[model samples]
Target: DPPNAHIEVSDDGQGIADQRVDGRYGLAIMAERAERIRGRLEIRPRHPHGTTVAVVLGPAGRRDSV
Candidate 1:
């Protein structure tokens, strides 16, 4: 991974009504996945429409030789 990796997933549909409380299983799953990989998940509304899901991740961990 690079110094800072930004994974942005956006759609041109209806955006998230509220950022704090979302009762969607998909969103929950995404959050879990991000956390599991030591990343940050952010869900926000687009400038015009739809939703924007951004996942910010740090560089990958170093692996030691066996």
Candidate 2:
């Protein structure tokens, strides 16, 4: 839909350590941008490996899948 969008970034490396995200400049910028577009930001660890970052937009961020 034109009023909705998403963006996801993931990695297979060692993944983000706990404190690394707090003072990080790049991640902060990304989160800010998401908020500006009225989107939600999610940062979580992957199943067996790294980290996943997801941004969802639209009403309640509900979607079938992408």
Candidate 3:
């Protein structure tokens, strides 16, 4: 069976300050995992707030037993 999963992360501390470009390692890791599992990751800014990161895991096709 195929299932859909959505993961969202949002914070309103400083709204992604303009002086921080050294904290994107996590995003890289997430992308790697997503690719390994045939998934995708999306990033966008939250309206009137901060940034939002969304990750979706697509279903893995059915496989027959060997």
User: All candidates' lDDT scores?
Assistant: 0.74, 0.76, 0.67
lDDT of 2 by residue, 1-66 (tens): 544676788999888878865555987887877777677688999979999998878665544442
Instruction: In angstroms, give how far residue 54 of model 2 lies from its true place.
Output: 1.0
Query: What's the residue-level lDDT of 50 in candidate 2?
Result: 93
In the range 1-66, model 1's lDDT, one tens digit per residue, is 463667898999977766457465888888877777777789888878998898877777222221
**Residue 54 in candidate 3 has what lDDT?**
80
Per TM-score, the best of the predicted structures is: 2
* Among all candidates shown, the one with the greatest lDDT: 2
For candidate 2, give the lDDT of residue 9.
84
TM-scores, all models, native as reference: 0.68, 0.69, 0.62
* Model 3 lDDT per residue over 1-66, tens place: 444667789876546554536756776787777666666778777878888888776676222221
Estimate candidate 1's RMSD in Å.
5.2
The TM-score, computed over Cα atoms with residue i paired to residue i, of candidate 3 is: 0.62
Query: What lDDT is reached at residue 2 by model 3?
Result: 47
Candidate 2 global lDDT: 0.76
lDDT, candidate 2, at 61 = 54
| Residue-level error in angstroms, candidate 3, position 12 | 1.8
